[model samples]
Target: MSQKKVDAYKAEKANREKIMKKEKRVLRLEKLIALAFCIVAVVWIGFSVYSKVNEGKEEVVVNTEMDTSALDDYLSGIATDAADAE
Candidate 1:
């Protein structure tokens, strides 16, 4: 082979360990990031489920009594005024 090719091969071989270490570090960082994302997703899902479960247990109070005394009095007043006008 040519001397230039031999020198380039030797240089690459010399730096192989450094390149491997860099690759391993990048892989470890990617794993950590993925793990963190999974943990956050689980926590968010758990909170949503907890809130939904508790939401169903709450009691709602509704006022169902129909009090129409004031309306009746108002209508009576209007009727009396109309009778007086005539």
Candidate 2:
């Protein structure tokens, strides 16, 4: 082969290898970004579930006893008033 042609082929091969290396580097960076996103999603889901579980554990005691007592008092007062009138 001519010296000029050999040199040109060598240069083209080097250029192709450089492009491949650049592509590999970019692919690695994208993989790292995707991994980071997955980590973030897992953490978010874990926190949300933890918060929901804790909320369910914290039960509010609704006092229906007070409501019933108030109703009983009003009814008794009406019944007494009626007996007094009769």
Candidate 3:
């Protein structure tokens, strides 16, 4: 084979290998970025859930001997007012 032909073939092969390497590097970088984003999203969601759970832990007090007569009277007054408005 001619020396010029051999040299051209070698150059083409080298160029193809270089392109493949670049493509592989780009793919690896994209995968890493996606993984990092997923980790951040998971942490953000976990923190949000933790905050919500903590906020829901409010204490509510109830009196066993509470009187209901005043509440009943107030509701009755409201009902009468509604009827009058109608």
| Collision count for each candidate, in order | 0, 0, 0
Write the residue-wise lDDT of candidate 2 on 1-86 in tens digits.
Answer: 99999999999897998889999999999999999999999999999999988986867888763458888999999999999999
Q: Using lDDT, rank the candidates from best to worst.
A: 1, 3, 2
**How much lDDT does candidate 1 score?**
0.98
| TM-scores for all predictions | 0.61, 0.52, 0.51
RMSD of each: 8.7, 10.7, 7.6
Q: Pick the candidate with the highest TM-score.
A: 1
The candidate that wins on lDDT is 1
Q: How accurate locally, in lDDT, is each candidate?
A: 0.98, 0.93, 0.96
Worst 10 residues of 1 by lDDT: 54-63
Task: Name the weakest run of 10 consecutive residues (lDDT summed) in model 3.
Answer: 56-65
Q: Candidates 1 and 3: which is better by lDDT? A: 1
